[model samples]
Target: MRLFLTFCAFFALVAVVFAWEKEDHEIFDLVSSIQASEGKDVNFYSWLEVSPSATTAEIAKAPFVQAYRKKSMQLHPDKNPHDKKIHERFARLGVVSTILRNKESRERYDFFYRNGVPVWRGTGYYYSRFRPGLGTAIVFLIIVTSGFQYAAQHVNSRRDLARIEDIVRQARQVAWGPRMVPVEGQRKVKVNLGGGPESEAPERWISMVVDANNVYFLHPDGDMELLDASTATQPAISSTWFIALVRSSYQSAFGRSNDLKEAEGVSPPQADDDELSGTASEAPGSGTVTPREGQTTSTSTGKRKKATKRR
Candidate 1:
């Protein structure tokens, strides 16, 4: 009997080993990919030779501009004819300086710099930031809004449709991400286990809502219909499922956004606003005021008084 019980226990361990859910595979695979990915973006601060905390007000000082000009002069293509790569470095220097010098551009870059830019966003992975541009909005409006108009185009239906889209958007925002499952009980969620360029994109996520008695899968053709969840795979899940959905939606919309930006005549890369036109204006305490080459400012009381009088 003791030997029989040992054999039974051994078999139970084997069964548990094989019982790892499909989601466990996907989650581990995705996280491992993020871990191994070579998607680290460049840090503009390091390129500019400035402290991370350096303020724009402080950066516009003569001392900083003097350093930039010195580097620019050395790296100027006319001067570095032998170094073919010097132009690229020189161009980068100008860009970094402009980004850091401008208050708006600097703030935008700093937000990503300090908070950490999302590596998995809008790439191969199912994660991206929500930045719906004018073009995307127009296409979506035409598809959904016009579809509503065609099918019983009632004003009330239009209002309800808009409301439903808003709710789904809000719910989707919180779905996919990292979370601390408490020490006690686990919160159960349902996630579809298939997705990629070749597979059914929406099938990759059948439905995220576990509580909705009648769940619906959103189709690629922009139709939402009631479906029997009895046959669909369901698993207790986490935010990672929702993140996959968000990434899928935003990435598709983003592709459309490129077309829209082009139509709207907005260039993706514009000259930065903080470009120094004339010599930088001297702000208060603009670093140590050094006399020009070959000129000396008198330190004696008599010469100082004389200079003040001249001013």
Candidate 2:
């Protein structure tokens, strides 16, 4: 019975050691994961750079003085209500803040940081001198299992974010119509006109010739005018009243006579140029002199008279 009890005690001791080893391994793994995520080696000089003149009191007060205070308050156990993760995070934050604040503990931390060494570096001296094969096998198993789990979670998170962004982009495309118009067989032209004091011509002229699909223009005082295709001459008529008459005539001929003013709405087919010109046609004479289609003629009895067409 004595031997059996001793064996049982030994077994219990072995089980406790196994559990402790497992816990330590998990801690090392977590530290490695954090280092990888942070993207840089933990340097000894970094803390000093953050606060070179750090006193014990200053270090202790630093976390609360910084932005982490608001985070801690929000993540505190009581504030978070029933949130287990927030409570765990809050506890971890407190632990980190405490370790970072203590001078002696911080010095040891700085040693590891400067050496680029992990806490498990002296495992051979601290832990039992176990067989190399067994130690390596145990570590390998833990690493493979944990690494697979981490990779799976990381990949899933990236895919989820990508899908969310794609959905948002599609919704935006629907909300705001097509963002671009394809350009094909398109041409652009720019015109420059000389208008300064040194220019020879003081007046500017700008002409858009539809036949040439070209625009010709000058600068400063010149005016731009559009002429009727049929009636306009090269040195175009400059009179405002004649231009208005041409526009009225065009509108009348094109069945857009409704656009004409009452004063200018005479039916062109029924009225001759003499009737259309009205006051302009009359001159101080014996009866009335009216200009014919091709030649100038006199109207004594208001009768039609043929005239030779000018070559």
Candidate 3:
């Protein structure tokens, strides 16, 4: 029984030691994670050292202004174009001056510097006070990452919008239908219907016609039609260059029409091959089509379909 008691005591001691070690390791890990999150060392007092407690008016006085102007001019790309480091220094100086010149920004900056250590409560509140450095680091990382993500998204959005606009502009430029052909040795041009039925207008038509100058359309009856300011005109049978004239006239008229403005307001709908395939297999006049897997439909149908993931 004694031997068993001694053995039990030994195990109790070992268990206490293990618990203590585990707590210590956990604390250490928490500190390390916080430190890793904070970025490189930033001089906390650099702003205060550069801008002192002087009033904005005092800081902007003749001597300070002259010194800043001289330094900025020297660091300007036009002056030190070859020195990248100097350019960065110049930009930093400008930022410093701007902040110092603002009374509120300068006062807040000074408040943090005079305090023993500013406790940032924004993002690292979970870190223990004993690990203040880690907390500060966490906050810094959060701010930097958020700022970078925001800037990247903004830039990407602008690039995408510009690209979309360019594509739409190109599509508009080439929207006219097939070209018209002029009769040989005749001044007039004859538009070939190309076996299409008469009475059917071109697939596309200009609704708001303006002064004829920029665009023309081919009619089903083998004739090129042109819009004009005073009246619409068809080229005489002797006009061998009818197609070119029709195109120019249509361009001039449509270029200034309200159609372009309307087009600008309309956004292009998204197209997916799967949705299109499904629409093709849908029953006619069903009003709604559900596409099965591995299928899509064309754009001609009255119902527009988008690919939806099956549950």
Candidate 4:
């Protein structure tokens, strides 16, 4: 329930972060366009060609109005038809002018203008500057999820190790008695592996052999398995789901290629045997022949002799 509450709170915060108002969006757009066109360090006051301390009344007057008109006329799409960004600039000027003319919006802009605009403002901020491709998002998610899986694996490993230690301690206590003195011989004991005093279920018992410091679980078929840290499943990068999937895919492909190579390699040896049989039938004497230039020969009479060719 606590974890669920944490998740709910996290999502609530995310909703608040993305729930930008129309005025906030306008401010974001105005800041983005001015910074991109004019300069990174440019702000609302400089973009309007006015002092930072200018009052809303002063800004609503002719000086600020004239500055807005001047910039708008220069950047108007009709005036600069060849400029693809003129439309954006012209629209941005209108928003900036509107923001400075209104008492409420101008104060909002001034708050940021004094305190400085946030360098980052959630998804919108990143989308405006650094939009990721589909492949990039996939790779990023894989890395993030794989990292989380590895962390969970480590947590599980620690838990398993603790369980193993607890079982070992129980078995050792049965063998070594109250003092837990070192025992000379192996002692078999039954221990409650789970559902102890803390649990409502009946105590579950298992037979195990305790030899000095070593502990082993005894099976019904007279087989014993050692129980220790080594028995616990260890965490590793390869154990993570994504890495395991990739490794299995690679191994399957490699095994398939090897099987194909073996299948292809078998026919060549059969062909070579056929060629050797044909060569033997074409030999001069009634005997098996090897495909070598100089060797001993057994003729039809079964006499061994050196086979040679005369020019």
Clashing pairs in 4: none
Supply the global lDDT for candidate 2. 0.48
lDDT of 3 at 40: 30
Of candidates 2 and 1, the better by TM-score: 1
Best by TM-score: 4
Worst ten-residue run, lDDT, model 1? 180-189
lDDT of 1: 0.54
| Local accuracy of candidate 4 as per-residue lDDT tens digits, 1-311 | 99999999999879867866657766877887789898998887777688867787898788877888887778878989998888887877777778777889888877777777676566776575578999999999999999999899899999999999999998998899878887978999999977878999888899999987889999999899999999999989988888889999999999999999999878543457646643765547876555344667777799988756555
Q: Model 2, which residues run further than 4 Å from truth?
A: 1-30, 36-53, 62-68, 77-85, 124-311
Candidate 1 accuracy as TM-score: 0.27
The lowest-lDDT stretch of 10 consecutive residues in candidate 4 is: 269-278
Q: RMSD in Å for candidate 2, one decimal?
A: 33.9
- Candidate 3 ranges with C-alpha deviation above 4 Å: 1-51, 116-311
Q: How far is 115's C-alpha from truth in model 2 (Å)?
A: 2.4
Better of 2 and 4 by lDDT: 4
Shift in Å, residue 173, candidate 4: 0.6
Across 1-311, the per-residue lDDT of candidate 2 in tens digits comes to: 99999999989766654543433343344345445533355332231234534666766565535645765676688887777566556665555455557776665555444454443433532354444577887776766765665566556656655644443333333333267222233122222233447777664323222212222222345543322332222232322344556787886786554545553866666766556643335565645544545664545787756665456
Question: 43-129, model 3: which lDDT tens digit per residue?
Answer: 222322334645779887886777678766766778877875665556555665765677776565455445522233322333443
lDDT of 1 by residue, 99-171 (tens): 7798876776676567754443322223222456889877767667545544543444555556455434433
TM-score of each: 0.27, 0.25, 0.23, 0.69
Considering only N, C-alpha and C atoms within 3 Å, which residue pairs clash in candidate 2? 204-222, 205-218, 206-217
